[model samples]
Target: MAPARPVVPADLLAAVLRRDAAGPLVTHYDDRTGERVELSAATLANWVAKTANLLQDEFDVGPGSRVAVALPVHWQTAAVLLGVWSCGAAVVDTPAEDDGGLDDVDVVLAEQDRVAAVEELGVEELLGLSLHPLGAGMTGYAGAARDFALEVRVHGDHFVPYGPVDPAGPGLLLAGLELSLGGLVDVAGELADRLGVRAGDRVLVDARAAEEAGPVAWLLAPLAAGASLVVCRHPASDQLKRRAEAEGVTATLGLGLDGIRELGRPAPS
Candidate 1:
């Protein structure tokens, strides 16, 4: 019998874990900072588990809770999104600027620099990320917000949701669109097919594309297609070709590199 389709975004991660727990699932790069981080399926799942435990135990996040994520496209952001989905909570992709959409959220997670701005939203449960290469606590941060890096480390490595997650419950919220937990999985599969994300393909995606495409395209779609990701931030255009080659990338998104299979472009000569 065919395996049942994933009911939520977390199921995609579970599928990857079951397939190859030790294989690299998400690889991140920052050219400007000269930082590269790779997370195997098991490692990423552990982070998700810890983050979920922290949210559930500390902030009481659950199926009906709403989380506002005011961060960029990084490996940590992937964990945060998956953690929220695992808990059957809705994630609001809060804008970096102070546009004021977080007033109603139960928790707000923001980068250190953006904590001051997010604090104005009056979210009582606020956490800050340093985005450090080593996942260190926010340096020199003296804000009321809790440190996600420090707090999450003390949580359990395995997560068991307090209750069953409703597949039809709210999952993601963006500027003008909202998707239920089930809808996220459905759209991810559709996007993977539409984008030609073949199974076992190692996909390289630039930060601009990740931001423009959102989580469905940059994160979930690849996972849904059983592909691994090489995410680049502040990508140096001149070095992208070498980086793609080094990463063994079979597909490129938001980058124009010769001999690479770019999205919406003909195969390279």
Candidate 2:
């Protein structure tokens, strides 16, 4: 059978699940914390499901809802974005409650360290992420904010959207960018081609550039192209080549790996 067409964010993730459930999807390295984590497609899907269920059952998040993601580039952030998108909700890339970008958002997902900033948003719902590599709940929060990892565990393993999602509806909302679900898919496809992303490619990327490149490039662009990521939040300059070789990276985003393909720059013109 020919491949099914992708229309929404869920479709893109479903494609990865069907193609490589057990294969590594995201390999995260945090230099600041000396932590590393590798998550497979299936594992990520499960996390997404749990998060979606939490959003649905707890916050009543569904289609047409808006969520402001105030976390940095991390594996948990990846899951959070995918979870929100799976529910057919738009992710508003806002830093604070009074950022003036989004008129009204249903919820705000912020890192524990950044909770104070979003707390002022006055949104009815707020979920705090620990940015933990093992998906652990935040510590010392008490009753300040909803602990994402703690509450998400109570949700079922699978997610079922309350209603059907319209693929042509608005999805991502970022500064200078607004795209429907269909448009997001199209953008991912175009990005994959431009960045030389393809199936079976193990890509090493710098987290800073990934964030600047936006989610379509940092997260879903890889899924959209059947690629896996080795994201380095901060890399020691001397270990770049060694790390790439050790990780079997086929391409790189920012840090130069000898003879490896770099995104956005043509080679041997």
Query: TM-score winner among the candidates?
Result: 1
Error of 1 at 95 (Å): 2.4
Highest lDDT model number: 1
Model 1, 19-128: lDDT tens digits are 89999999999999999999999999999999999999999999989999988999999999999999999999876554487778999999998988777767779999
- Candidate 2 weakest ten by summed lDDT: 94-103
Q: Encode model 2's per-residue lDDT on 151-246: one tens digit a residue.
A: 988888888899998887778998867898888898998999988887889999898887777888878778888899999987776777888899
Q: What TM-score do all the candidates reach, one by one?
A: 0.96, 0.95
Q: Which residue ranges in model 2 land beyond 4 Å of their true spot?
A: 95-103
Off by over 4 Å in 1: 1-3, 266-269
Q: Give the Cα error of residue 97 in candidate 2, in Å.
A: 12
